[model samples]
Target: MKWPILQAFPSFSPRYLRPFLRLCAQQSALIIGKKLHALILTTGLSATQTSFLLNTLLHFYASCGDILSAQKLFVEIPHSCKDIADWTALMSSFSRQNRPHDALRLFAQMLENSIQIDDVPMVCLFSVCAWLRDVGVGSQGHGCVVKMGFEGKVKVSNAMMDMYGKCGMVREMRRVFDEMKEKNVVSWTVVLDGVLKWEGVRSGRLLFDEMPERNEVAWTIMVVGCVGSGFSKDGFLLLSEMVFHWGFKLNHITLCSLLSACAQSGDVVMGRWVHVYGLKLMGTEMDIMVGTATLDMYAKCGRVDTAVKVFECMPRRNVVSWNAMLSGLAMHGRGRVALDMFPRMIEEVKPDDLTFIAVLSACSHSGLIDQGSYYFDNLESLYGITPKIDHYACMVDLLGRAGRLEDAQTLINQMPIPPNEVVLGSLLGSCNSHGKLQLAERVLQKLTEMNPLNTEYHILLSNMYALAGKRQKANSLRKVLTTKGIRKVPGMSSIHVDGHVHQFSAGDKSHPRTQEIYLMLDDMVRRLRSAGYIPNPASQVFSGSDGIEDDAMDLEEKEQALFSHSEKLAVCFGLLSTKPGTPLYIFKNLRICQDCHAALKIVSKIYYREIVVRDRNRFHCFKQGSCSCCDFW
Candidate 1:
């Protein structure tokens, strides 16, 4: 298919050869392009009158994706022969390769030398600005565009809106969009994306419905935008709308967004749907991103077995894929298995900061205090990765949970970065669990000073006072919270049945089946008593004080408090609704109190069921009157 342009023109005339080189450049013919570069250098055509021949060669190299060759030629170009196009060609090449830092440096050099750029190449500069979110440089580019009179160009204006949006100046983006004389689909999409970033999905949806025409990218962006904005349920609906009503085919981006929504909401049914949709669309050609997201979805939804299947069957695994599996195991309290994967991970793939975090978290949850310490010590020395705040948080939790509070405090004091709320919170939680009130008081003092608005720490301190029989101190703190309008966040629990998520709270009787659920609870209590499950009376009084009255009033109060706990209600509902001995999974918004954890262990043994519960901090798997955490959690 190679054309003989030079053979036809043996004299190598400028007119004939120039036309032939331009054709080869447009075709991006690398071999012919190289021959033409050699011809120009040997004949000294570039030095005779102009460097149009050299510039054409530059375009040819760049267009063929030979960025290194194009950069070399541009560097060798004579100062007199170089023009705006020559500068733009090299800049565009770097920008297209995602080397924005290099691209911007070249732009700065162009400005220093006063090389004029037309509107077309200005798009590349604006794109780099958008991606980097460099407001100062972008404003300078905007000023230059004004001076050069490219203000009315649609592509330039679109890029400007994108840059402004990424810089968090949504008002300026809207102004540019309003001022533009002509607007295209890209302009609308950019504004829509900006709205999603600045606000929520509702605003973006309004703009999307108002658009004159929508392309595939615009539709996909809208769907992903909802997931990113934390309106994951809305994201799922939009995906359905796109496929069913708009007749848009499901792409990798759309599927990944949907999987994220499924994970956030813990909607296993919808996750299965997305999984099926992926198989239907790709049919043996699974995208690694889609597969990794699927693994994440299953793991977060408490189906670790399914996640393992997906991980094993994946055609390929990247670092992210391995991290997802490790995180999944850590989250679901399979810390032993999670730790087992580490040596294999080191053999095959390199572990980063996130990998160590997952490893430390697994060790913390499983009471592998020694293993957690080993990883924390070797994090920098063995892995050559600096320990971030999350890794430090896991270590603090590890030491504090193992009753090494002094070591935990020393680690915090020795942290390279200032200890944040999470590190302090982990220590405080361990303090509350192990009855270390003095350290709790000190941590609370620092926390309250750091964030006066945070009532959770205040509540924790108050609860500690209540537990220690300092009722006046607890009452005084409660009065101050009421005065500051800081009400405690009520704990909530939810269980997924079929596709619907049912919620329960302390004393919650809002469900239509409340009567049936309560009746089921009564039956469960009768059976539990027969099987030697007596309620722990200490749970009723916030104070763990000695000498409880066995009077009728005291007994009634204890019974009412124990029965209305949110997790108990959710568990009773699951027991009644599902088949016998079926595995039940529940998610709780707060840490599982000691009484609830104790009650669930007995319930599991009596009912012959396995219950997987995820509380605020970690997972608890109850079966046969035993918990996976072995009373350490």
Candidate 2:
């Protein structure tokens, strides 16, 4: 398709070239742009005309993601003709390309050339600073903002706050917020977000209450932040206020954020409500973001069948959408189904890094070693994705879980990049599972060398010792930990009931209905015993069990420790509170113990109730005396 101007190139006016160049840049018509550049050179335009056109030409290349061309053209532009826009455009291109160091270098050159800084360039500089997380450079930019009298600009001020917040300079961010003479919704929201990151949900809520105006973004931030930090009740209340009280319409991002929060908190009631609301708001057509988020919420909340329905109904799908479905299946221990979906995914949208991570994890969870090995071996050759640490971690986990400890170790040693905590941790977990005490010790030594202050690794090894009947070694380790003032992080579990989340620790008595909870637990134990539920001896020695002493324990004491584990307490409370046949959703901060897992299997059958537990690793759905994982997990 030839443009009319190209047919009559000789008669083309310089003014005509400006709009054509502008259009080419707008649409990123690179070939058309190259022809126009040739025409400009051949037409022999005057110096001033060419100079003006050069700025637009430079921007065209930048807009098309041709950083090299943009840089070359920037160099070609005469110093006298170059302005702040040209400098800013090139710097922005570098920033967009994730070359923040290059952007900083250009900024320095612009400063050397005596180019005046404006709000736009300063904002770009702050973004680069944020990406670099360089507070020294960011502080210098703040000084420049003050020096240049651009401090009053809202966008500039917001960028500064964002940079500071991302760099963990929360106090500086707050100071900037306090000193601002004028504040808008974004201003309040930025400060609120920073406060949430540094000071936790309670402080964020306090700041949110004080805001003069609340928009959807501010509400979303507060809601997601609260739910993410284990404050589900407050998060739900905030959502209610945002909708019913303020009558604010929820956008897809807001809906997605809320759904993700619901997933994190395992609040199925809220998740279902959000799904229905999204359906109504967006009509029958489900876009990718909302659909994927809704699917993830269901999957995380232990409803993979519903997630599959949502996945099938989505009007559009991307790699992320496919990954969500695959991950959902993986979470439910449906590895073959997840693998089957992978072929179908690549038939439509191309798979990415996260997609492989989900697939490999599925294989690992289901003990599909052959399939996992094939995919991992061909990741680079077949998919053009160089295996990252996460991929290696998944492979390690796969081999380790299958009792191929030597093979897993060999793979880790052969990895190009060093194994991260997750990779080594996977191997450590596998070693413990297989009772390879010597191998577990070696892995623990490597883990401790990598992160000496990581208490979880120490506790894992201690639990192994206790389980192996080496009580002296376990007691010594516990004493050393206590002497060093490093207390083990207690396990916590929460269940959503009647729109309120009830949190419990082992032996927790904090609930108002504590007496009833204990009585219900006593009944559960009796019923479980009648149903032939014996506490796992391994579960008894888990190091973080609350109220358990470091001293050697008798068999009766060990069994006592097992009964009061956090998930059991939460389950007992759920049973006591909810009606008969009501499904219970439990979210735990740690993995479900062996005793809880076995007991919950019996509890589901005896009580005629379905129990879904989402622990740190994956989802477990118990029904009719069987678990969704089929005892693999």
Candidate 1 lDDT trough over 10 residues, lowest sum: 542-551
- Clashing residue pairs in candidate 2 are none
lDDT of 2 by residue, 209-234 (tens): 99999888999999888877777777
Model 1: per-residue Cα lDDT over 1-633, one tens digit each? 353655777666566667776777688788877877776666555555336566767777777768989988888778988989888888888888888999999988988997777886788888999989998889898998899989999999999899999999999999999998999999999999899889767888999999999987788788667655545566668778878998988789878877887776667777888899998888666898999999999988888899999988887777888999998888777789999888888887898888888889888888888888998898889999998999999999999988899999999999999999999988998898788998999999898888888777777767787678786786677667779986667778888775557788876799889999999888877887887777865564442111122224466677766766788889988988889979898888777767778888989998899998888766788999999778877
lDDT for 420 in candidate 1 is 92
Best by lDDT: 2
What is the C-alpha local distance difference test score of each model? 0.82, 0.88
Q: What's the CA error at residue 64 for candidate 1, in Å?
A: 15
Clashes (N, CA, C under 3 Å) per candidate: 0, 0
